[model samples]
Target: MPQISAFDVVGPIMVGPSSSHTAGAVRLGLAARRILGEPVTHADIGLHGSFAATHWGHRTDVAILAGLLGMSMDDSRIPQAKELADAAGLQYAFQTVDLGDVHPNSVRMRVLGKENSIEVVGASVGGGRICIYEIDRFEVEIDGSYTVLLARYKDQPGVVADITRILASYGINIAFMKVSRKTRGSDALLVAETDDPIVDDVLELVRQLQGGIVARRLPRF
Candidate 1:
């Protein structure tokens, strides 16, 4: 006989199956959707390593699609995600790729919306946990455990301070912060993990700042 835990369940609570293949994959897709902040009209998914090898058997493909549709890990609709996406007119395709030196259970999604597109790379680290490692071309580390603020802006001096100032005004405490850029004076990305939710006003103010292209708040799933 064997023991079972919550993480083994594909759904909620009771044990079901592999957490890395099901729940973790679901969370990865959900995180990417939250970062995009819009309905995905198309998704070009790249499955890597173990994810590619076992995707079909584990239902990882459907899991990712369900997450892109904004479904939770426990949502029974996950199994029917393909049909739902078709009904919603969301186009999607999946391909296998070799992402060198990455985790075995990794996926890269290029999600396209009517107005914008986002590329996210993440790894399912098992036990229903995941870590997002990149957004677009910017390297990041998001564990989906905290309220997060993500902003894209022109690479210039004082922008970081300006964004932080707005958060301070909202009385929100910072838990962590990271900045990534391609080159000097180019577009840059800022990711701030917070102790509390950011208000809409503060988010708007940050978006209004000079060089601000986009600002989005991601709540923990």
Candidate 2:
């Protein structure tokens, strides 16, 4: 038998009628927002499978908007997310689309900021948990259970080692790390989940690395 945690038994503290649809949807949106690393000015959301079929009735749309606005799952404003988005100048639209061979509770979000943009694909697995599986065409596995450091760079020798060295120097323990590349010595995406939060100074150090394009920290959700 599989072990069960407190969260699995009691669910999450949230404004919700269902953990999978509402709470998980909120977290998915939040993950997208954090990965973008800037205020979301516009968002184009594509719902899939069960999410596409039942999102409106379950208020998954509202939950996603609340998260994009940086609201926690239990925020009282979740019910008014649409109005809030309009007031905050957040342009958004939602449509159903086939994401292909993924979880039923999946969604693809293309979020834009003033100077940056990101595309994220994620799914709400149950008990209010989520998994972010893709970011900007790079396959990843982020579960929002650890402080994550995302680095995008031109793939080259010693890049990963230097980043690990920096984290080690800061005494931050890495729980998991994955690097995905389009081709050898080409563009690469590194996903590092650390036991401790990555401070701003450390992030800046990583940002200054040769060939580093972007480095962002995503706090555990």
C-alpha lDDT of all candidate models, in order: 0.88, 0.92
Model 1, global lDDT: 0.88
Q: Which candidate number maximizes lDDT?
A: 2
Estimate, for each residue in 116-159, the C-alpha lDDT of model 2 and write its tens digit. Answer: 89899999998788999999889999999999999999988888
Score every model by TM-score: 0.92, 0.96
After TM-score superposition, the amount by which residue 55's alpha carbon in candidate 2 deviates from its true location, in angstroms, is 0.6
Q: Which ten residues in a row have the lowest lDDT in candidate 2?
A: 4-13
Error of 2 at 71 (Å): 1.0
Q: Distance (Å) between predicted and true CA of 171, model 1?
A: 0.7
> How many steric overlaps are in each model, in order?
1, 0
> Would you list the clashing residue pairs of candidate 1?
9-16
Error of 1 at 124 (Å): 0.5
Residue pairs clashing in model 2 are none
